[model samples]
Target: MAFLAWSVCAHPHATGLLPETRLKFRPPPNSLFAVLLRSPWWVSLLIAAVLGLVAAALLPEAFRVVGALSGFPFIVIAAIAAQRQWRLPSAARVQQTQEAVSAMAWPAFQALLTDGLRRSGIEVQPAPAGDAVDFVMERQGLRTLVSARRWKSARLGVEPLRALQAARQADNTTADVPRAVCICLGGFSDTAADYARAHGITLWQASELALAMRGVTLPAPKPAR
Candidate 1:
């Protein structure tokens, strides 16, 4: 149970450890994989058990063992789904976290973002001078640049994201293509979101930020000057 909770918390996005260079693959909406992934983890387990029992009872005695083995596939699927669905925060908690983040000053928000990334098992470091992004995050030998300095902006446009995308392309120090992420409190303009999708850049808007900071303690919001 503990490990499953950690798995969900560690990979807040569907891409898991992979960079957001492409859309994450998803099963069809009505498919078994989709149903299992969205349902409670125990539902898959229950199905497995019921299938084994029914198969065993319906089959001849000589083939009873073989019939019970039919549920093995579901058992495997159940374990995978459990790791993703367990210990997810309630909607209310997500809302509360977003509210807290919205009220934070840049310094406080930057600290919160760093702490949250660390908890997700990503090594965070200050971005090099003149980089458009504010931080560089590394995991599994791949680097991802993160820009959050304008997180408090009322509306993010394509210009800032375009700068990050250019920075990502220019960073040739590593073999792997560096990914980029842009964070904002009020969300991005339609054009900005489209630009990000085209360039494979990840955008951390209100909900994404809330999920990432789930269990981390948020700094107190600074008073206005």
Candidate 2:
């Protein structure tokens, strides 16, 4: 049933997190057919009805079995579709939260992100002055240092992350810090991406922040170097 409805509705593209990258999800040319195909559960139910109608019109003598059995195959499918449709409102609310997050200023977005993380059971506090990180989070005796940066498109390099790693290493000597992460509102540069991947540094980028801020599971962190 999750796949029985449209996934992404194409709209004007946003200011991509990547300054130089474009993301696309192209649908087929026949939109009505596409929408119908998207809802296979409903389509299945419609087929059952049509079969029953055909039997009623042309085979009155044998219509009972057709009327009785034509619809059962789609009963489970209908239930699943109904469940998915019932969840659509919640999905819409999450999407609305995501949209608001996308358009927010750095300060407001950070506040929302902190609050969202808080709602997800993590306690967050502002990092120290000149600490090269933004938030210090704790949950179940684990601490994570997070860096959040805002850029128009994430064409930035890795020096900042390098500094954050250095800070984390420094704190390891005196604190219970086991992990640290970087959150770039803009996309990361190739060097930054590679460095994070190689070093096990977790990264949460622009496109992910919206859903993440709404309490969706965050992306996996990169492996440590």
Candidate 3:
């Protein structure tokens, strides 16, 4: 099965099929705090730890005891965060988390994305020429082009995503299908963000990947047009 899947993916030109029908969709309201919520949970605990340390250093004896008690849990949590950070893919090898996605063979890449989507409660289906745009995702009758790490430029611009949007339209299994691009390590140009927002393209960056993997509802971005 693995070999067969590879054979099919290795030659994208051979397999060309449209994704499912799409529905008009919107991401949930997002705030800085909401974005932070999806971030590594450790960040919050670390903030708490810093506050506790400040208390321990400055509070009087009677109050100091309260500070110490408040701080203990945060200290422990910080230690846990350190351990988890250690387990993440090496930044050296993984120039960007998206790099891993780009580096993997087609079968492996598709599998990883599919698993992540399943974990996030999104439905994934194999499509022809999946590698060209990585695969397709569907939820509530909505289809999206799901991809990661395909950009070569340092700052992502609007062209690439626009092309995908064009492809989606050309296929036209449905007109409302959206494009969801993962910007795991790089930043986007203001124009890129504006283009994505105007086109209703969904983007996932940094800790937001955690939210995406969990299929967390996204907040609509409204970059100045």
**Candidate maximizing TM-score:** 1
Best by lDDT: 1
Q: lDDT tens string, model 3, 1-225?
A: 211221111110101112111112322439433343345757757777677778878998679767756655444435444544543434433434454444455566456656766764567876536343666777656666755545334577776677666656665667554545534336677887898777666665544343333332222333556
Candidate 1 lDDT: 0.74
Clashes of 2: 8
Measured on C-alpha atoms, candidate 3 has an lDDT of 0.51
User: In candidate 1, what are the lDDT values of residues 21-64, reduced to their tens digit?
Assistant: 12145457898867776787788788889988998779889988
Candidate 2: 10-residue stretch with minimal lDDT? 13-22
State the weakest 10-residue window (summed lDDT) of model 1.
Answer: 1-10
Write model 2 residue lDDT over 1-225, tens digit each, in one string: 323343333221121111111114444647543344348457767866777777677676756675656555455445445444442335555556545655657787677777766765677877856657887776655667777754334455788779878777777534554467777655688999898777667776544455345554433333568
TM-score of each: 0.74, 0.50, 0.45
Candidate 1 lDDT at 95 equals 72
Q: Once model 1 is optimally superposed onto the true structure by TM-score, how far is the C-alpha of residue 63 displaced, in angstroms? A: 3.1
Candidate 1 TM-score over all chains jointly: 0.74
